[model samples]
Target: MSESAQQIGEKSQVILHFDLKLNDGSAVDSTRVNNKPAKMVMGDGSLTPNFEKCLLGLSVGDKKAFSINANDAFGMPNPDNIYHVDRTKFASDAELKEGMIMGFAQPDGSEVPGIIRSVAGHSVTVDFNHPLAGQDVIFDVEIIDVK
Candidate 1:
């Protein structure tokens, strides 16, 4: 890296490789899996403000590992995110099972993934909360470039 290499800041375009891991050191995701680094512009809403703060002032070729608390990471699960729907709403051919993730259509035509929490006689409980909610995480990153 050059001494004058750009540092990551507001609106700066950055390219980097990163690994997302749980507090237990279990890997959740990583750019290294396919050897394709991620590219993003700072403050573009692709990252949470706290997550972006971790990248501030980092320069090319810099490597960092940071841990974020549960609330600051994916956030704590919300009770409102859990909903009970009629079993008939599901496809007749669908085999509903605990821990199954299914996509539900939204009013805007987009899809949101919901995890089946429980299946009863006539109702199914689905949790729309993020899978990693309430979990602390570690982010390991290597800055490839910042411009």
Candidate 2:
């Protein structure tokens, strides 16, 4: 008994199994192990509109699969998202690892996360953009239950 996407509205708790893949048909992530279902509320930012649309009205024990483009997923990469920081920022005891996420403070008294791209003697290159930016992803989802 699968419900249509329209039946799954805002604030409705839904449990689903998700599988993510790249355009090359390579699997990236999945939640099928032990069938541990993930829950989410419709219309929440957790699931994109396009992705949610695919599950509009779906009853429990329903399985659905779909894909989202780069814009709908992680979005296109921005050139301005790259930044270089002084090597001194790293503590002497800290080891710089590429792809490591670090927090950066902004002038507005807020903090943002960035990933380490490269490490030079006196400079450390950090990329603030998301790791999946500029890439299209194919997501497969199954509605385990909707409450």
Candidate 3:
């Protein structure tokens, strides 16, 4: 589709490529490398308000770069999200290694991924932070489509 002058707004379905990077130019996440452009509905809350606001006045095919603070991007990590789990909860046949991520089921049957921070004796420290939390990031985007 040819580029349109439409301003992104609520209910607009946007298809775009994004690169999330650290201030040091280290990439954190990118849809370009993954070769799968992302699709987001403007008002769905999938993209943080600050992130979405950057696209508000953009038109299709527009490329833009912006920075968002840690709190505005993925809020700071909360200590309460960290948990100490009994080693027994791990599958006996599975490897338990620090920095490894594992899926845990909550009482509500939802699965939450936890990253292992340490394993000592029968306790394993798992952090449930979003990973990019507490760090400022730069976002580069190429708007592919807006409908």
Candidate 4:
């Protein structure tokens, strides 16, 4: 490759390492620590629209860090996302405990994750909100490739 490469465009494919953190510096995820790079097309659903927008015009080997509000990143937590399911849904073989995340199948055959919040005698509350909802997040990214 030459020393100068064109900046990323709308349809470019990108490879990068990223660190996602909370305002308090708690690590949500990181590709650098895993020694793996992430690759994604610009307009694909793999990357959030806001996150992709941040990468536009960046060239290879560029590193940048930025912060975004929760609503723009993962979104605010919705009260409707909390569900109270019947305790019987869990069979004896399955464990029913708080803070346990489970995948539930929907009518469209897609699976969404739900975290158990509480377990009562006959009711179980599950929260479907993303774990990072309603929090400010900081993103640190290093562009490894832009094609």
Q: Local distance difference test, per candidate? A: 0.93, 0.80, 0.89, 0.89
- Candidate 1 segments whose C-alpha is farther than 4 A from its true place: 1-5
Each candidate structure's TM-score, on Cα atoms with residue i matched to residue i, is 0.94, 0.80, 0.91, 0.92
Number of clashes found in candidate 2: 12
**lDDT by residue for model 4 over 1-147, one digit each (tens)?**
644454778888889999999999999899988799999989988889998888888888799998999989999999999999998777767788899999999999999999999998889999999988898899899999887
TM-score leader: 1
Query: Candidate 1 vs candidate 2: which has greater lDDT?
Result: 1
lDDT per residue (tens digit) for residues 1-147 in model 2: 434543566667888898888989887777886677778888877877777777776766666667788888878888799978898877888788998988878899899889999998889999989878888888887777677
User: Residue by residue across 1-147, what tens digits does model 3's lDDT show?
Assistant: 444436687678999999999999999889988699999999898888899999987888789999999999998999999999898988888788999988889899999888899999999999999878899999999989888
**Stretches > 4 Å off in candidate 4:** 1-5
Per residue, candidate 1 scores C-alpha lDDT tens digits across 1-147 of: 555558887888999999999988999999999999999999888888988999998998899999999999999999999999999999899999999999999999999999999999999999999998999999899999898
Reference-based TM-score, model 2: 0.80
Candidate 1 contains a number of clashing pairs equal to 0
Leading candidate by lDDT: 1
Model 2 ranges with Cα > 4 A deviation = 1-6, 103-112
For residue 141, model 1's alpha carbon misses the true position, in angstroms, by 0.7
Write down the TM-score for model 1.
Answer: 0.94
Error of 2 at 107 (Å): 8.1
Q: Which parts of model 3 are misplaced by more than 4 Å? A: 1-5
